[model samples]
Target: MADERATTVAGNDAEDLSFALSCLAAGAITPEELKGWIQLALEQSRELPARVFELFAPGLANALVPGWRGLIGTWPGTSLSAAEGRAVAGIAHARFPELQPGGAGAPDRAAASAALRESPAIRDRFARVFPSIRVPDEGEAGVGCADAAESGAGAEPDPAPIWWLAGAEDSPLAPANAQRIFDDRRTAGDLTTMLESDAGSTLVLVTNRARVMIMLTGLGGESGHATDPLADGLSGGFLLDNGQEDEYRDRDTVALPRALAVIDHILTHSAPPAQGWSVEVEG
Candidate 1:
């Protein structure tokens, strides 16, 4: 039974998952985009709502690189339209030529996932691969998205909250408390608490608690310093050399993209702030 779920539509390396998560956590990929990737995968694969795509699409899309949209994009809603089915089949026909209908390795969806399609204990299959990752219930059949409601044909799933912030080991963002911030926009209460308030009042060391990164968008003392993050890449956030993981940062001026990529490559844990990471406002 355990051997049954090795459905390798894509790779599942730990470092790869960690990198994708780091980008998501470090403000490289907005949560909106991560949600977009999940919606795209779920749209086509009704067999989704399965954790494989629900929690794993961000990594899958990043890993797949270019062929992702064609591979995962599907019309959303109660039914898979005939045209939509053909579109998916067309993709499989092109990419995995031997794995489509009338080919050498063709296996219908029903045959491929018969074991998981209705099983109540679906979470059990992915536990070893992704510990600490939350698993959704084995939802009702034809349920649209694992995290959001159904949308119209060819539509996208509504965005869902995900990617927990690493508060402190002791105060790790509990599932319930995590949602309170919604996006990265941090509260004054958070700033005062996290930074002990020392910098310019200009660079308030907004802590990571900000909604998205400021990324040097308006790097000036005049207008936008207080709300800015310490990191200087887009959507803005900071990085630290925790001394545990091997570092992969870019030192040159053309840095943001590389910095983000570094975050993806360097972050092995993929969740929470690092240890000995006492918050401080860098002036």
Candidate 2:
């Protein structure tokens, strides 16, 4: 028991030092000052020197701690500030060389988000990752609303494609209706039908890679709360501290999280599980 506690303490201390080193490498701190600090930390302690090597040198820590996984949770959709994101990006770049977390300063975020808004690659990934929520059938060549009418196939308006492929086509509460809900501050009449039926809330998840979706029910109730399990099961999520009204807060915090939770539940706890999708292992 004591040995296990000591190992846990050592691991925590290592993470702290790693984060500090990453911050310094990102220029959030001075390299010279960090060098001095690292030297002092190393000289004063027995384990910290090994810890520093574990953090800065790749494959070393994994060798030392068998079956170890780095960090158990992802932040609620890249919630890190520019400085914070840059720090992590720096560390990821140095260590993994393949990962590139997005931020305000990253051109890749804009490009990838835009591409995901239309890309079939994203939709495919979404289906594989979370399958309980129905993925919309892509139209021929995935032409948008402007071209769909010209092609003269389905008269019903389709939901606008976003990052994670949620929402439906020809539902009374279509993409335009969602726009009205966001912009006009009124639920669509068709949406009311779903509410009356006790169906879940319409949910959307947007990431640089894809848009994921699940429905949230009971939005019409007095409590105005709905749930989805997949989203709820996620380790962390974007949250609002100031009653969700602060301009600094992402608006998704209001509608996205609960809807995500419902989706999570459906995907993970639903009977038989969806084919080609598996439950995420608990860390």
Candidate 3:
């Protein structure tokens, strides 16, 4: 965490954040301590770090935890929200890199390679579709023709090829409409349909990245409130006394500890496993 941080909109100011970061740097506050503070800041305000907090604490945490970080996310979405869990942890851990439970980050080569080996499946997928891929006669307008994109008689090809052959010009799409990946015997056809669907299906990629992702998700309810997991003290976060009451009572002494439950919820459930990658969260 730098001494000079970009300003934040979550009511917490740069000065407070910078002080928290400084305390974090000086070991006055542990990683978990700093995380407790950030989670409080995130939950009460229900802000996305993207739209709100910008700094990655303790200065540069990893090269940035990669792949499938979020999808169709919003403030209220934190109800059982996987995106929120990952975001909070990522922001907190980055600021305190010294003792991350993890050491390094990499993909699950065995699983990734296995997925890569299935490239042949792509060809198999196109085999039937290709026969139906009609090239509109050069001069004739075949309005109903299922061209290349429909099966390859158009300007674009399957983008998956470009990712492998040319290497991605950028990373994969994220914060996308949640996707559901169904791994079944229907092979390519089933997958194609699933990929295009609106509802969600879980086929996540897990990496033992130094930046931790709170693996415990979905404990709260879908409606976003009635069964909210953090509903007790956290649902209505408190402001520091800041002499606001003029009673001279120490608000932080009590208010700050409330954040521990959220911190503990994350710590209790998160088990990143070994330092490698896998295709799914280890059940």
CA shift at 280, candidate 3, in angstroms?
Answer: 41
Model 3: which residue pairs collide? 1-58, 1-59, 57-95, 58-95, 108-277, 148-152, 148-153, 180-201
Report the lDDT tens digits of candidate 2 across residue range 1-283.
0111111113334543444344433332233223323433443345543334433332332221221123212111223345444333332232222234445555242233234344444344333322322332324222232234445755664332221123333344423233324222222211111211113333322221111222232222212122222222222222222223212122222232223223333322222113312232335
In model 3, the worst 10-residue window by lDDT is: 191-200
Number of clashing pairs, model 3?
8
Q: Model 1: runs farther than 4 Å from truth? A: 1-106, 117-125, 140-157, 160-283
TM-score for all predictions?
0.21, 0.19, 0.20
- Return the lDDT, model 1, position 131: 22
Cα misplacement distance, residue 192 of candidate 2 (Å): 19
Which TM-score value belongs to model 1? 0.21
lDDT of 2: 0.30
Candidate 1's displacement at residue 60, Å, is 12
Best by lDDT: 2
